[model samples]
Target: MDHAELTTEQVLNRDIPWETYMTTKLITGTCLQLLRRYDKRSESYRSQLLDDDGPAYVQVFVGILRDIFKEETVEYVLALIDEMLTANPKRARLFHDSSLVDKDIYEPFLRLLWKSNWFIQAKSCKILALIVSARPKPQDGSAANGEASNSKRKITTIGDVLKGLVEWLCAQLKKPSHPSRGIPTAINCLATLLKEPVVRSSFVQLDGVKLLVPLISPASTQQSIQLLYETCLCIWLLSYYEPAIEYLATSRALPRLIEVVKSSTKEKVVRVVVLTLRNLLSKGTFGAQMVDLGLPQIVQSLKAQAWSDEDLLEGLNQLEEGLKDNIKKLSSFDKYKQEVLLGHLDWSPMHKDPIFWRENITNFEENDFQILRVLITILDTSSDPRALAVACFDISQFVQQHPAGRVIVTDLKAKERVMKLMDHESAEVTKNALLCIQRLFLGAKYASFLQA
Candidate 1:
């Protein structure tokens, strides 16, 4: 009810020790209490506030939970959290400092995550995300000394809850309905859980990789690009562990990963995929296995990009120009914004790894000319300019680098695409396209074709 502007310092200044929230009644009870007070304002709000001596944040969180529990007002609750978390992630992290890991609320809330309503599922995932990603402060500890300090007991309780959460999340992905909606919400929460090393281990223990890897194949945006991108990132996070990496070594994930990387025009998906490959290549044995499976060529193709900024490629700009009209007519503006925010992956460390790129590129025959066809089509139709530009660079490099490159390029009719691209608006696209055509012309075998 109090709409006063609480500054960052004020919001963070916890009025009660975080432990008070651990009491079962604090969340649901206080929420219901607060809602009743709001509805029946005949009584003084100050008198009601004075009656409950709990911290301001308790009321704040209780208020948050109360609104989310309501079927109608849940969207507003999520939007407020999104605003707070975006303006200052620490604001939400501050709220997360409270203990809400109770199976009572957590389990039921998680069940709602698989429901058909988008707001219900999204709000549920956001709550789970807060729980998993928030790092507890030292004060959040000593208060729980009686129970939480008992290290072994604490581990048992936390581990059991994590196991259940992980299990339910895997099930949500397999659910037949809500492919475009409910599943993405659940997938986002699963990806958040992967932030913790301990949680990541539990995910693998529950056969999480088996459930996730199949979703990566060829389905980037049936619902939205966020689902596919987050799924890839979660798998990338899992790859850091020996057990998950070992599973990927033997599983069908590699070929599927290859296909996604080669064809996906989604930026975040492409970026995280590089991280995934780096994780695999870091392991010497797995690196060798992947090379044997023909991953090196896939990595090499993306590596050969000519444009400095992949987002600005000429062909991709034209593609999006064509797509923008349909996007506006078919969906809301919010949908496009959601795609941008969700697809944004943090890849700073990935680029810093010299060994990752060094190990990924090997001098060998990429005998599959089908790769040329894929790149040629990608160069022409991809909405991400970087993808289009990269396709151009890849086709040029494939023709120039491999011994049989010319034969592959000539057979694929790649020269025609490159020539059309020469007149493209982006200088980078024109540059890469011309470079590709030049490679074709260099060979005497294609010299007669150039004349035509």
Candidate 2:
């Protein structure tokens, strides 16, 4: 007996209940048949089936079909499509035509999952995110016709619905699970939905930045981290439109961003951090404000990172463009310089005076020694106390490292200055002088003289 031959009443009155039939693969297969029939220009089958109700019925039937198709017979699948297209063209058009209107019919199931249990809700969010993200984007300079007319310029109600759903999803993610699935799906959904400015703004308004901050680390799964990257990108967009900077700076985002920037793994996360910083600093004078609020820590981190000088150079270059006259403040390392340099022993600046003094202490007889001697002659002509201190320290460390270079350090004037710096206010210079003193005693064969 043909399954379609059974009347709705007969079907409802059968040994199985309507709920069972509605859920079974038979009904799902039947609906897909009806939908495909409608796709093929068969109006009569669609009318017969769709006459049961409006969009809500169509939605319920579609949802049921989604539930049942996995178990249905192949023959039933073919017949249902044939019936639906024969019955109603408009209803068939929903599937045959891949457009925003078609997506409308399928989106409700995702929305419905908001009220479902954990696993179902997570799956629904993933599916919905896929649908939303996969929707056709508008083209440039295309005719403002067809689906464009249906797709309004304003933000859709869909974004609001999605935002609320994601908020609920994120709340559930606070729990530990048998398998951690909810967060990844929810983040994917959030990323997809956030493609819209309105959706992105909604997330920002709902403290989404704070929620996303915790998820930015590479410790999270790759997909989860990618979702985080997308979320950060979304936040980057929001940074310009809303008070996102205020939120990012105040919330956990700033620290997480700094951590990612400093992390040895995850350069992509670091790239996003750079972008987020760029956005935060976009307001010109506001960029300088970051210097006080943990910016120093971030800079300190960059200084210690493997690419310290390169990253610092880029960052300082950015700051210089933004601050113009006040850029010199960044180069001042009076407090952190010694520590940073100790950690980065290979760091050698291009400044001729420091470089010349460094090379002189290493090998004054080398080719560059003439240039170094000339620089030393010029330095001897100046009496700037700071200049004298730096030149003395540079030569002192070089000579200490290479015993042959102590010839340059034995100058009485340089010795007096080094002794003065031993009591210098800066602990860094004083530490260096103490170090040089030990080297001076060791190199001079004056061990007993030092004891005296």
Candidate 3:
């Protein structure tokens, strides 16, 4: 049977030769006693034993994994541990008990991650994540436990364990061991592990942020929806970290997130994506980008829906307000200045508004005409036809609106650049260039008539 399809219940059904292992000295008498009580037992029975001596069982299991090499026995031991953790996740804390402090608890699972079938790899990944999360904080040094001198017995550092796990998870994301389960398992574990700051740092350093962007689309099936939710959850966590946010800002993350939020009916999916947007809403340029992506109307449409999650509702409200503020801010001269300074010239409504020109024309003289100089630079260098046309039209606007518009433009050497574009292939560029030259040569009054 393919291990990829094997479940813990199925693996637990097998009867192992505990006596033979005992006879061979592979497992001590104490381990055999624990196994006899745990193996093939009902849930109530195993739960009692775990509740009584959970650390002992954890020690036996970790020891077997450290010593045993037989595939069948190893799978059985891993299945037992996986089942125990699934039953009561808090039982993971047993692996960190002071009694087991000298044991190298993390090495077996980290080693199995690279050398096993899909079942073993998946289970090891999950178990390792839980154990790492349950470990003591560094601030609680060995002195607090009165075992300061025993620190030398520790085999693996938390940093090494996290880095190893991140490498394995990234490898699974890049190439799956199981055709279907590999990516989902990797993402599931990541959704939990990334809550740790160290995991987030390691993931970002590995360039794993891009690995998640392709998974951010709207999911249809039950399984796919859960995967999408977890994927977005990972993104939401990363949004709190600056380096990850920087990567997200540059990647396709925002557009893909908007696409998912726009189409998803699943409340959890929408909630997480909205929360992610709220986190990014205040970051650099994301405000303008979200507004430009038509998020405000989407927020309105979402508000009309009857979502039960209060966080989602509150997020919708917050995001709506934030985007509204962005729209207002973008409508101001500062927004226009940002657009021009960033060299993303476009024919947004402000470009042709007569009132806009009249109201803010003199404001352009601040900083030695920094905004106008950038416009002239755009004419000299921009390749996008729309950008070039918008640049030409804007320079013409300054030339017409400012009292010394023509003189200032000529002194800045913009007339020669505008003249060179008079015969360009794009009609918009040619037309705008002609208007600019007319304004420069024939003055604002005649230029306005020609523009009309």
Candidate 4:
């Protein structure tokens, strides 16, 4: 019985009575230890588990967990759940099977997931998503009423799960630390849950639309940006659900999305925002929301900007293609002017329309110039090559207008930095800087100081 002499096979196959050894202490320490060690060396364990000649040890070891959860002991059940989640994939795969899932175990499983330490909570949420997704659908019997009744029951179950998950999800997202882990895990869980039609129906039923504002809000961390995007993607998928599109339109998400599109400095964030915009706008309900949020100006800027960053630009183009039909919504905002002026301006696909000058530019009497000044200040001091490039591009577009250029030239100190950027290594920077230089000299006539 010496530990070093015992192989995993011997340990697994050597069964002690569950009643004797599966008490609270044994469940927390010894059982968890086995699950951890097996999972830690998962590849090796899996190699053995999946092999045709593999020993029967894994099945026996897994049976311990099965027996533990069934022991009518809450302590043992919670500990077993933790062990399965923290255990390596090789060991965890044993628990992944649907045989372990049941209505009685479902709610407790969720409670354990929601309350676990942050590191393991991610895996816990994923497990819950899988369990809900795999729940059996009711039979499609010959009785017409049977199908309807089954559908209603399925919908009801999905609603309960969605509400529970969302309630837990909101609390998790509010945590200040480790959004990098929490957000993506939540997003993946949401994505997985969407696989079932009943779940999709429940997603709409559960006020998921209202949940999106916080997901995409400025209060969110940089870590949550992609997570927010993925949630937006979830909303995009749910766009087809009954009344969901209308719900999203009424919710604050679309305006927030437009703000992210207009204001985000990160290229990846912008790419995601635009793509989500495209997806939402493709549908009539959400498309109107985009228009109300000033979709025309944003789309115009995006189309004109060169966005030479291939990966980022490619993402933006994909978003554009997704919303290609919705481009019509942008027409009345001065389609002719933006096309005639910016048809040739090479800029990031993430930029807004330049033609707002003629129509809305003159009417900026109520607009906040403080933000514009702050943007100029940021562009002057920023060292990030990508950000500097975007700043230069935006400033140049703003200055292209005859009156605006003259006004900006008097106030915006762009010449000093454009010269410094002559030494920049990034093509996006050089390209954007060169455009700024061209505009500075061409219309504003600041070339003398730039040359000096």
Candidate 5:
């Protein structure tokens, strides 16, 4: 029974049944305390949990969480996770080997998140974020389909766990007086969760914008500059989800974000502000709205203005990139051109059906009027012949596909650009432009605009 008499093998091989372990709190506390120690740096201490050649840790770890949550002893569970991550941070071998991804554990984690203890809620968020982060990303676009076999292997094993986690985080945000560190902590976890496209889509499905926008809006009174930064970061990361881009482009928080970027002296926050706006601008409507909102003046004021503070350069390049990028979308792909000008053209299932267009043309025209103009501008002013060629093709496709799209294109004076392109130096541009002109003539009302 003496401590010195115990062999390393004996300790490493020890197993506790769930029924017996939860019978007494002392045994439960000691196991968690030991795991917590392993989380720290130590010499001459080789935990049995770290055996170079030992049994997989998944069961042991899950057993502890199961028993702890069953008994409602939530205090030390997070420490165990923290220690596992800290001890082997680069690999997080223990956590990856554990049943953290197993669906059965979700109930307990969810229960812990709702506890009155904000720290417990924060830790639960962290643990869930880490588990989701550990998921293996798919190798190709085909893997994105939900029916793909790899879908079953996702990190969040429970179907609704991630959705529930997002709901909880948003609920906390709606609270009037947030817990001391809960909001930022939840947002931090959200940033981690948002890295995955699937989870980004989930955030939108959960109505995250409604919850997050108020925190970053200029009108919000309880402004923690840090909160705004995190909010912007989340929104920026989510913008990469193409399905979600339209919503972000149209959100009311957009103008407020511009105000923050223009006025805030904080470079880190401004970096997110610019990155987010830049992302939204990739969608043609947001780019046009920037013009509609008079964003040009703000970008002009900040252009090349030196910041004496060294800290201001934290995201200066990126902030400049945002401004530089926006200029291209605003202009005619001229000298100020920032990024490739294009739109999503791979028609979705709904878009391919003709009946869908007839019913949706009104909304489609309102949505696409500015984008159509962007294409027209590119066709007219871009010196890059290939860009002009693509612009002509895009316009031609829009007119042929959308109901009354040809009429709209002609009404916008696109006919002038199309006719001019017929003599363009690049044969590709001339060909595509000729195609667009042909499409234009098919319209009922192209003659007035087509006349020289």
Candidate 6:
């Protein structure tokens, strides 16, 4: 059977030779007795044994993983550990018990991450993530659980463990070992791990943020939707970290997220994407981007739905309000500044609104004519005819509205760039370039008449 096809239930049904392992001194007598009691037992029976001697079972399992090289034994032990943690994740803390302080519990699982088949690798990644997360945080160079005496012993540092796990997870995302389950498993673990600041930093440092953008789409199947949900969950968690947010701002993450939220009917998917949008809405130019993506209408549409998740409803409301405020802000100078600075010029209403120019014209002079300089640069460098045309129009508007409009435009050497566009192929570009020249040479008074 393919190791990737092995399930926990299938692996658990195997009868292992615990007595043989004990006879060979591979496992202690105590470990044999524990395994006998644990193997083939009812779920309740196993739960009771673990509840009574959870750390001992953890120790035995880690010992077998560290010492045993048999694939069957390793797979069996990992299944046992996986089942144990899956039943009660709080049992993960057993691996960090004060009694096991000297043991390198993380080493075995971290080693298994790269050594074994898909089943072993996947289980190892999951178990490692659980135990590492459940470990007592260190303080004053001591374990928080009072396991400080073994601090001098060589053990796997949490930093090394997390870094290893992140690397493995990223590898899985980049190229899955298991055809169907690998990416989902990686994303699932990341959704849990990214709550840690170190994980977030490591993920961003490894360029893991881009790996997630491709997964942030609407999913139809139950499995794919869950993957999408968890993927977005990872993104939602990342939204709080500033460095990840910086990466997200530049990537297609916003548009992809907006697309998911716009089309997804699943409330959980909608909820998470909305929360991410709300987090990013306040940072940098995300608000403007969200408005540009038409998120306000999406938010309104979402609010009309009868979502049961309180957080989802609350997020939709907050996003709606934020988008509303963003719309108002976009209608003002901030929107124009964002458009110009980003060099994505278009024939938005701001370009033709005389009132918009009359009000915000002098505001452009505040940044050493930074807005005007970018427009001129756009004329020189931009290949998008709409951008070139809009740049010409905006320069013409600046000349028409600002008090030193003509002097400022000419002194910035924008006249040559605008003249260069006058003979361009795109009529929009040429017409706007001619209008700009008229405003520059003919002054705003005569230019206004021509515009009329």
CA lDDT, every prediction? Answer: 0.54, 0.48, 0.89, 0.52, 0.59, 0.87
Best by lDDT: 3
Q: Best-fitting candidate, measured by TM-score? A: 3
**Residue 9 of candidate 4: its Cα lDDT?**
41
Model 3, span 1-452: residue lDDT tens: 88889988888888889899899999999999999988889989999999999989998999999998887788899999988999999988888888877778888999999975988899899999888887767676532111222656657767788999999999999999999999999999999999999899999999999999999998899999999999999999999999999999999999999999999999999999999999999999999888767687688889999999999999999998998788777756877876786577888999999999999998899889988998999888889989999999998999888888988999999988998999999999999998888888988767777763
Error of 2 at 386 (Å): 9.0
Reference-based TM-score of each model = 0.49, 0.48, 0.74, 0.48, 0.54, 0.73
Q: Is candidate 3 or candidate 5 better by TM-score?
A: 3
RMSD of 3: 9.8
- Report residue 368 deviation for candidate 4 (angstroms): 10
Tens digits of per-residue lDDT for model 1, 360-452: 223223344434555677755666655555567655655644666777677777788778888888876777777678777786345324321
What tens-digit string does per-residue lDDT give for candidate 5 at 178-290? 45566777777787777766677777887777677766753333457777777888887877887667666567778888888777766667667766776676575676666
Ranking by TM-score: 3, 6, 5, 1, 2, 4
lDDT of 4 at 417: 64
Worst 10 residues of 5 by lDDT: 332-341
User: Which residue pairs show collisions in model 5?
Assistant: none
Candidate 2 structure quality by residue, lDDT tens digits, 40-108: 344455465456544433444445534443323222322333234334434443331332343343444
lDDT of 4: 0.52
Tell me the spans in candidate 3 whose CA falls farther than 4 Å from its real position: 138-151, 331-452
Better of 2 and 3 by TM-score: 3
Candidate 5: residue 323 lDDT (0-100): 49
Model 2 TM-score is 0.48
lDDT of 2: 0.48
Q: Who is ahead in TM-score, 2 or 5?
A: 5
**Cα deviation of 46, candidate 1, in Å:** 16
